[model samples]
Target: MRLLAAVDLGEGLESVVESARFLQEGLSIPAELLHVVPTPYFEALGRRFPHLRPGLEEALSQVEKEVQKTLADTGLRARVLRGFPAQVVAGEALKSRLVLLGQRGTGTLEALARGGLARYLLHRGEVPVLLLPRALKAVRRIAVGLDDSPASLSAFRVAEAWGRALGAEVFGLHLVSGQGGCCFPTYLDPETLGLADVLARAKAHLESLLKATGVVEVSKGDEELDLLRLAKAREADLLVLGSKAKSTWRHRLGRMVEVLSSQSSMPLLVVPEATVW
Candidate 1:
């Protein structure tokens, strides 16, 4: 089980490296650092004007050297490749247990326009992807969304494993919809007898699914907001969620995954559909 840390020539490079270190130590897995020099623009320009090929090659070489220097003495295996960044990473992910990426925290339009790696991998990649914000340095607490699906179960297992490894508190959150609308009665509201029954069922289900104690919590309301609120209440530093698979792109990413991907303030770890333990 190897972890692949994808780095780029961005201001978040150091933070990504730090995140890699955290995972390397906590997960007890060997990590390979990769820097992919995008080739689309250079390849197109070089094809149009053959004279620029040598210059582009030299520039690429320089970038590789810079990446090597940055990774020096970091104790991580380093390699550089030239291709479309997302494609290259996805290819590498086939052999990796997890892929660590540094998100620029860009908005929806900007991310789609720039072809965000996180979003792309979340939908299509084979392995789970761990996205770290530039500001996150460590993982002390983790929050995972739970459901009966294999992907959601995989998410909880990952949360449990990482939490045990890092000695971080793990929180399991399950959100239920209200009677007719998106929102639901609070789990603690004694006035709502319906909520009491729902909360009992939710806890019992999670207990059976997780086989763990005191880590489960149930919420009723907006899926995104309730999950986020539970995470915030737990003071979690990492949020874990699972994505579902579908024939169409629109259905591949669940509404909760879509919302948290853009709105999460902490680092996000997305477990893909049909992920194996």
Candidate 2:
């Protein structure tokens, strides 16, 4: 599959380079890089400065140089474009199998790559977008949220493949909630799975899913927050989940993925069931 990576040369440029390299080796795919120049803004400045063209060209040239230098001998084809960063990147991402970007921490303007652009793309079903952290290393452990739905099942397949490819451990996370505000218990077993038929089915499904997917560890959480806590405690390098669902109400799960992507420090990989992977 072709990978499209945006090189902003911003706060997380180094991490982006590393992420691209990781994908290159793991996915064994060709990568095409694009660096966007704020053309409209520069044009407005040129109207007044009368000498902005040289600096603009230099800025574009510098980004090209940095991307090439950092990805030396990696065979990553790259190009420089002029437009709003988000718009340009999203338009190109429409044709890619995956998109990778380095997301920054809490900051006003600096968070554009993750804040504005990220949220927009996360809502779109074009392709899977992998958001990398500002600091990164080789991926070793991957945690994937799971449910009985086909979407979750599809995500698990993709996550498991990545785990095997990277020689990483894969963990399956399932959340259980019941009436009377009951959530996942601190301890779990067949009894904890509950005596109800539905609960038994859920527990059975989870067990079967994890086993079939070759997930090394299985954990149950009461809520999404608990999953995040377990992920952090487990020192997982990446988290994966389905991007959307079939039902209207269930589609809200993607919102949870969006929230996890923004709050978690680790990279979040959302796999789409509709994707032709």
Candidate 3:
């Protein structure tokens, strides 16, 4: 499987590389480093000032050198291309099993473009996207959002595999939304299901779905806040959530995904519904 790490050479560059190194070493997978240059803007400038064309070439050459140096010791192949960052990364992501990127974009303009590149990939990209914050140094624990739905179960499966390969502990948090407090509720309010019964049933479902043993916490609260709280309380290095490309009436995993994509403070791994591993 291919692991693609897209870097912008910004403040988050180091964090992206750090995560890439960890994944490469821990998972023993081949990785690639890709840097996308906004060549169109440079070309526009070149047209406005024809004499500055040589300097633009020099700048691009320097960028290539920097990219190569970044990949020198990591055993990662480097590719410098020119295009819109989101489109290029999304297109290449189709061939990759997972794509790593920084949550914030490169420069002020990119950053100001709210939820710019990462959101595009999350909604349109075919592969799983892993977003790392600048402060992330390593991943030692992974917390997964769990529910009885297959989408959440699939996320746990991916997280479980990564935890085993990386030698990290995995935990599950099942938020019993106020809409329904029971995991196996037949109605909005199941009169027969008690809180203990809900927790037990949810834990059992998680165990069976994951086919693994770990701490699975079932609580009644908001999904997004409770998930973040669980991760923070556990001191988790990564937060894993499963998201669907399209919205459905019965499930709204994508909503939680979009909220956390921009708000998560730690590394976030989003497994797309179509992802196999």
For model 2, the stretches where C-alpha displacement exceeds 4 angstroms are 44-75, 107-113, 178-201, 209-220, 245-253
- Could you give candidate 1's per-residue lDDT for residues 1-277 as a string of tens digits? 6899888767767777888887787789988899888889989999999999999989888978887887765677888888999899989998899988776656778556434787778878478888776645678888888766667787888778888888888878888776654434233344455776877777786778788778788777655767888887888898899878453376577777877777676788888777775
RMSD (Cα, Å) for all candidates, in order, is 3.4, 4.8, 3.7
* Higher-scoring candidate on lDDT, 1 or 2: 1
lDDT of 3: 0.75
Candidates ranked by lDDT: 1, 3, 2
Candidate 3 lDDT over 129-152, as tens digits, reads 898865445668889877766667
Candidate 3 ranges beyond 4 A from true positions: 44-63, 66-75, 104-114, 135-138, 180-188, 211-215, 247-253
The local lDDT score (0 to 100) that residue 20 gets in candidate 3 is 79
Candidate 2 residue 276 C-alpha distance from true site, Å: 3.7
Q: How far off is residue 106 in model 2, in Å?
A: 3.8
Among all windows of 10 consecutive residues in model 2, the one with the lowest summed lDDT is: 179-188
Cα lDDT over the full model 2 = 0.70
Q: Number of clashing residue pairs in every model?
A: 0, 1, 0
